[model samples]
Target: MASPGERAGEPSDRGRPVNDVQLSKFLSYICRHGAEKKGLTVQEGGYINVDDILELREARKNGYSVSDVQRVVANYPKQRFSLRSKPNDDGKLQICANQGHSLEVKGLDLVPILRPEEAPVVVHGTYRRAWEQIKKQGLSKMSRNHVHFAAGLPGEDGVISGMRSSCQILIYIDMKKALEGGLLFYRSANNVILCSGDENGFISTKYFEKVYDITKGVKLDY
Candidate 1:
């Protein structure tokens, strides 16, 4: 499905093309959660070689080429991924998810949030039922590597990713209490606050400064 002027394994000559949402999902799965299962070696920081991805049967069947990958990444609205050429310069690129990894990404590029001032307003978005469960057990990482947090409320200026738009409740973490309690937090490339919950994989409610029913625009009694 290459365009007349577009060629496989080559960069496009003009402006970036519209992103392929389906391809985005495919790459997200492979780099963020399915590399090993898909028979690709995910390197540190969740990177998989571009050439290897193109070799996947599904990719080939969809006619995805190197240019398609680059164009899609270039046009992606969110900072969901990073694509880089190796120092070896083997005419191939490596791709990785910026955050939201369902798998371990050891040494992933993240900024340490050492003080409350660094991320003054940290929140997690969820619905009512889940919030009720979170109220009892606190926040759990669930299956992911870390609990994801938003630097600012959804749709706020400079806050582009993390948390879904349909969330009915917003749980705000008291960064001061969380940090004083020996919890760790990092800022992902997409500006998400990644919290390494306690040894039990949960952030106790004692660290929550505020919980609000955002749908109703009212603060809930914690």
Candidate 2:
């Protein structure tokens, strides 16, 4: 039997040696091919592509922290890394069509201030009508307890249950801004008031279904 010193000299047999380049190539292949084969259409542009897993593994092998890989992959060429544990359903809002100048909604407005545990209020509507409803309700008016009836509560409303509740709203826009930013839809667990924004700030128009549908189809160039 080998002595303790002899055994210690032998290469560690615990883990496989990681090849960074090979791992990267494997990940890239997984990202491109796995997506095509699986028919995983791009949504909000953040997920674990094959390369991400490889990079994460290779990071472990190199004695580098997994977090380092996470940060790098987060800013990866394709925007492929996300710490978000859940799939993001938020959609983009943009100018209705070629008739208007190119415009994108401010992403900050929709970013979540609360976590899923908090259970905020959410809402959805066609592009044109979102803003009109918000203006009619007034932001300050919405915070009060008994004012939700003004927004037309549903008979089987999923978000609002008890007659009195305290909640914040999360809004999403479903209009196209560009070809890549297709017709979008927003849904949240909380009670949110939808609104429209002029590529600059929230606009006053209430987008209806026909208008939103046409815009969505037009953005896809249907």
Candidate 3:
């Protein structure tokens, strides 16, 4: 079992061609959940020193190199990782996860969605079994730092992240209501809308503008 601070690798865009998945998952594991645990100094915006990261025991054991890391970061369809940024004081490059971080990383430079007009169709995708509980208890961030919502439906132009193609249900959020209720919203670098929800760590049912069973093509009561 993964210990308190450790976590299994999380999902990303489906059916998107990727190379070096084994190495990619390792990199993702480090950036999103294991940087602090691995003793890498995570800086503002969750950026980690690549020199430090590539020097990890596991990375060294596997003979991973900077170009290998850069290849994985560049080929990931969702653009989950950012590499080749301006060097630090010592002239070493860095890397960071665009979102889906459990670390209390400040200044990820996420764009705030203050007005509903900013994301006209912010919606969370899930399954019916979860929705049964979600309707009553509201959408929770679960393992992540914030609840993820796609800016628009899958296959919709410009909608690249935030959901899996296999989602069986879709819950539309009233952004105006969410913001009015004091739930802050931010857009990740990959265009995923994120909210920590309310103080209780749930986005209440009151903010659900509509719910639909995508498999049935019918609206469901919430």
Q: Give the TM-scores of the predictions, in the order they appear.
A: 0.88, 0.21, 0.87
68-95 per-residue lDDT for model 1 (tens digits): 7887777665668898886577757999
lDDT at 203, model 3? 92
lDDT of each: 0.82, 0.29, 0.81
The digit string of per-residue lDDT tens for model 3 on 39-85 reads: 88888888888878868997766666676666666666666788756
* lDDT digits (tens) for residues 1-222 of candidate 2: 322222222222234433333433444443323433444332232233232343344334653334333433333322222244433434321111100111221222222222322223322323334445554542222222111111223334443322222223222222332112321222212333332233333332232111222333432111
Pairs with steric clashes in candidate 3? none
**lDDT of candidate model 2 versus the reference:** 0.29
Cα-lDDT of candidate 3? 0.81
Taking all chains together, the TM-score of candidate 2 against the true structure is: 0.21
Candidate ranking (lDDT, best to worst): 1, 3, 2
Alpha-carbon RMSD, each predicted model = 5.1, 19.7, 7.2
* lDDT at position 68, candidate 3: 64
